[model samples]
Target: MEALDFAAESLDAIWSEGAIYNIGFERGVSEWRRFIKPDGILAVSELTWLTERRPADLDTHWREHYVEVDTASAKLALLERQGYAPLGYFVLPRRCWLDGYYRPLQQRFAAFLQAHGNSPAAEAIVEERRHEIELYERYGQYFGYGFYIARKCHYG
Candidate 1:
């Protein structure tokens, strides 16, 4: 069965961390809103611009990779438009990336590279991950993951 086969308004809460970006933030919110009970909550974490004026290089990189990335206010506006009442939101700390994700990934990538030294595909994948980490190190101050918490409006 497809994903939507689940009954509507059957869930008390819906939480989507990093995965929502895969479906596009606006679309994800719009689609998932139907699955929640009127008073249910939706908590999502998405990439957001932290500063009003971003450096050109960082802006260019995200525009190329994730064109939909926007400021937290913009995301809140979208939530409001989609019938969600904002409760609270916070920017994830840098440690969430460096400590929780990238560092462990770097260790794994190093092991994978050693095990597959002969594979060009493996090298390319490692290189891409390295580049992402490097970009985060340099431009982390301008943007980050934002956790948004909201309650579904009764009318929606």
Candidate 2:
């Protein structure tokens, strides 16, 4: 995938997995326009700030690493300008079962972090995982990652 020069031409569709939060919705939409076919779709899962009110304890680690994001309305507007419109939006809340999903390798991840603690990259990994766990355990709400299915519009 690294060898492909996608920007040189448009793609049939762009699946933006776990990227909207990383790049923020605006940039992600712009990037999709640059590489996606005019009639294609852009699908993404992202943490949306639906309201302007900021959470008092926004995860520090996440904020530092991922740019602070905006509401779905703001994102919709941005996407519209890029010739795309939202088709659907949905959310999947965190549950105790999710912990089971990670339990198998939780210890392994911890051990890896311990062994690589002194490195910058390791620190980032540790901080992110720790904050996710904390949010799930204490607030019963991990990241509210949202999915937006958008399709490029045609203009005469």
Q: Give a tens-digit lDDT track for model 2, residues 1-156.
A: 223367633687878766555556676677657677667888887766544554467655456656645556766777788789779777645543255534544666767877886588987776777666665456444345667788887668
* Model 1 alpha-carbon miss at residue 9, Å: 0.5
Off by over 4 Å in 2: 1-4, 7-9, 50-54, 59-63, 95-105, 114-124, 140-143
Clashes per model (N, Cα, C within 3 A): 0, 0
**Per-residue lDDT of candidate 1, residues 1-156 (tens digit):** 026665799989999888888888999889999899998999999999998898898888888888889999999999999999999999999999999999999989868988997489999988878988998999899999999999999962
Candidate 1 clash pair list = none
